[model samples]
Target chain A: MFYLLDLLGTLAFAISGVLTAMNKKMDPFGVFVIAFVTAVGGGTLRDVLIGRTPVGWMLDLNYVYTIIASFILAVIFRKKLEKLRKSLFLFDTIGLGVFTLIGLEKGLDTNLHPIICIALGTMTACFGGVIRDILCNDIPVIFRKEVYATICILGGTVFFALLELNLPINIVYLLTPAVIIIARLLAVYYKLSLPSLERK
Target chain B: MFYLLDLLGTLAFAISGVLTAMNKKMDPFGVFVIAFVTAVGGGTLRDVLIGRTPVGWMLDLNYVYTIIASFILAVIFRKKLEKLRKSLFLFDTIGLGVFTLIGLEKGLDTNLHPIICIALGTMTACFGGVIRDILCNDIPVIFRKEVYATICILGGTVFFALLELNLPINIVYLLTPAVIIIARLLAVYYKLSLPSLERK
Candidate 1:
């Protein structure tokens, strides 16, 4: 089930990249590169940090095949997608929850400090999007004291805390994404923001 | 003396980044970020790979300050820069030479295999420019079989070979850049290029 979520998340992210490149009128080659980067950039960084060899996509050709498939799908359905923006949002939101959990799990498996795990989770959820925006030459929306990464950090914390409380494993798994999606949705709808500290 | 070379390299790289942002017509804040990233991105990757704590720029506020100063200088001279096409290229070459040496030295300090050190050197010399292009939404020239990174790898190999031959330290330092510059000039003049694998 978790692996399926991971694959879905990769697909959604690749389509997001394809959409952005299409908006920019990029060539097919450029669109493919952006889609690949958006889907795998964060995991590659996580693997590099953990000293995992050959990177995630390099080891699992499925990830590569999925991104390519999604890019082709995006191209064919370009006009149809305009009416499905809301559905695309659903996929993106789910991807955020799944990737965050995967990141936190990987960090725990490596026996890293819990704080670092939370950081990794937040990065896994957001950095690919950030890289996409950066490449698109815009100010990253998540950087401006937004509730973006904070949502993932808080959600990961809730997951581990519940596990310590001896919550049922099945309950914990279900609750994790539920909590994150609700938080993120609220943050986006009402512009819930983190306060910035004044530089002195 | 070694510290001076390092400083010169940092300055040159920071300037190249500033120039890139200028070409994009970015504001002062954007220029500062581009400059900082170009100056330290490669070394930060190297340190992270080696598990070094507090990558060099984070440890030294001076590097950060230097980038800021360079950005200010770039802004003041933006008009002059706009009139000159080759200013960025000149600094980029110097930056590559200095980065190659620093990367080679750092790898030697860690006692990595010679071939790995050469890889490190080429990565250090070229990766920053690759990143700058990516952020600017240009195709990464490195992935295109350009002569750019190859020059750094060739010169790096020469550095180690000369060291083993017991050449004078000054001669080694001077000879490395000369080789890189001459090779780069020849390649550019002759329109040398790696054959691109035919696109499928």
Candidate 2:
């Protein structure tokens, strides 16, 4: 089940990357590279930090296949995909939730400090888009104006709190992702965001 | 000698990052983070790719200290340092040369393909600045213009070719970095760059 969620998250992230690259007028090679980075960049960082080298995508060919599939789908249905803003947003949120939990769990497994685990979760769920935006020559939306990473941190906190309650491990995993997804979806729905400093 | 060169490279990269962040008007924390990233980002990426976990910086605190020292020096003498542009350029170029060789040697140690090793050399020497530019909300200068990474690639190719000739190991090491430094310095001196696509 976790594997399926991981794959789903990867596909969603890849599609998001493709859409962003397309909007940026990147060439085909650039689009594919961006998609691959978006799908796996966060996990790769996490794996590297924790000494889990050879990384997740390298260990499994599924991620590459999924990114390729996503790139093809996005290209074929560019117009249609653009029109499905709500669905795209949903997929992105779900993907963030799963990815964050995966990172949190990985950090936990490494016996890292709880604060570090939360940071790892946030970094894992968000840095892919950060990297993608960097490659596209734009300030990352999360860093500029979004409640995105904050939501991941919050979800991580909840995850650890629930774990401390002696909750079933499986239930904790399920609940953690659910919390992230719901938090993200609500933030989007409410147009919630962190305040930006305005220049005089 | 190699260890000293590595430390110097880290300090130079950190100084460059500090200067960039200062121009961006970031807070001290942000400046430190950027400096840290610029000093270690390339090697971190290379290490991660080659399955060296915990990364170089995490294992040794010297990098951290060097970055801190660079950051402090950059902050204190920001105006005076700006006047030392030529010296700074030389330091940066030398740093790039040594970093590229370190990456190439690491890749070769892992028995990676020659092309991959060359690419690793280029990435290790260049990606720090790329990441810095990205955080500064600019397209990486390397990708947009200059013969920067190309020099590293050229140097890597030369390193391998010389190895095939069975040159003394010490001479080969010295010669590879010398080639990179000279190529980069010449490129800058001549204002030589790859041809950029002109818009119609």
Candidate 3:
């Protein structure tokens, strides 16, 4: 189930990349590269920082296969995807929740400090979009306004808190993503955003 | 001498970051982060990709100190730096040559393919500026126009070719960076750039 959700997240991220790159009028090769980066950039960075060699995607061909499929499908259905924006958003949120949990688990496996674990979780959930925005030549939306990373940080905090309570590991995993997904839904519905720092 | 050139490269990259961030009118914190990233970003990415954990700067305090010093000096001398642009360019070119050699050596240390080593070399020499440009909300100048990475590739190829010739290892080290630096200087002097892929 966890692995399946991870693939779904990758698919969502890749589709989002395709959408963004198309808007930029990028060539097909450029679009594919963007999609690949958006799907795996964060996890690859996390793996590298943690000294996981061959990186996650290199070891698991599933991710590459998934991104390739998503790119082809998204590009073919580009016109129709407009109507599926809400579905895409839900999948992206699901990806955000799952990727954060994965990062936190990896950090705990490495016995890092909780603060560092939280940072890892947030980076896993957020940095792909950050890279995507960067490649597309825009200030990252999260840095500018979204409350996206804040939720990931809070979710990681909750994850560690649950572990402290000696809850069953399965229960901890279940509740963590639940909190993150719900928080994001509420934040977006209410149009909540972080305030940009203005120059004095 | 190699270590000294590495430090010089880090200093050059950091100062360039400071200049670019100031142009963006970022706050002090943003300036410092940019400078740090510009100094270490390429090397960090290289280390991570190669599965070298805790990274180069984490193990060596000198790199961090160099970046801090560079950031402080660059920020303080912003006005005077305009006159020092040529000197800065020289340092940056030196960084390009030295960093590419470092990356190629690391790739060889890991027993990676020569082609992959060339890629690692180019990434080490150029990705700092790539990250800098991305964060500053500009398409990477290297991807658009600069002949920067091409020189690294050619230099890396020359590095292996020299080794195959059984030249003394020290001579190979000296000549490889000399090739990269001289190529870069000539490219810039001639106003050479890569052609962009245009849409019909």
Please name the candidate that would achieve the greatest TM-score relative to the true structure: 3
lDDT of 1 by residue, B36-143 (tens): 778887877787777654356645667776777777776677666555546556666667777887788788889999888888888788887777776666777777
lDDT tens digits by residue: candidate 1, A1-200: 87777888898999999999889888999899889888888877676666666778998899999999999999999999888787777777888888888888777887766656765677788778767787677655454445667788789899889889999988887888789988888888997775432111
| lDDT, residue B192, candidate 1 | 92
Screening candidate 2 with a backbone cut-off below 3 angstroms (N, C-alpha, C), the clashing residue pairs are none
Model 2, A116-163: lDDT tens digits are: 687679879988987898888875667556788889989999998998
Question: How well does candidate 1 reproduce the true complex, by DockQ?
Answer: 0.06
True contacts kept of each: 0.04, 0.27, 0.26
Residue B104 in model 3: shift from native, Å?
Answer: 1.0
The better candidate by lDDT, 1 or 3, is 3
Q: What TM-score against the true fold does each predicted structure earn?
A: 0.57, 0.60, 0.62
Q: Encode model 3's per-residue lDDT on B1-200: one tens digit a residue.
A: 88999899999999999999999999999999999988889988888887887789999999999999998899888899999999999999999999999999988998777866887898898888878987888876665557788889899999999999999999999999999999999999999875533322
User: What tens digits encode model 3's per-residue C-alpha lDDT throughout A112-197?
Assistant: 99999999999888998888887888878889889999999999999999999999999999999989999999999999988878
Flag the better candidate by TM-score, 2 or 3.
3
* lDDT (Cα, tens digit) per residue for candidate 2, span B1-200: 88888888888899888877766666554566578779888988888778776667755768777887898888778778868887778888889999999999989899999999998898899999887887888878998887999999999999999999999989999999999999887888899999888897
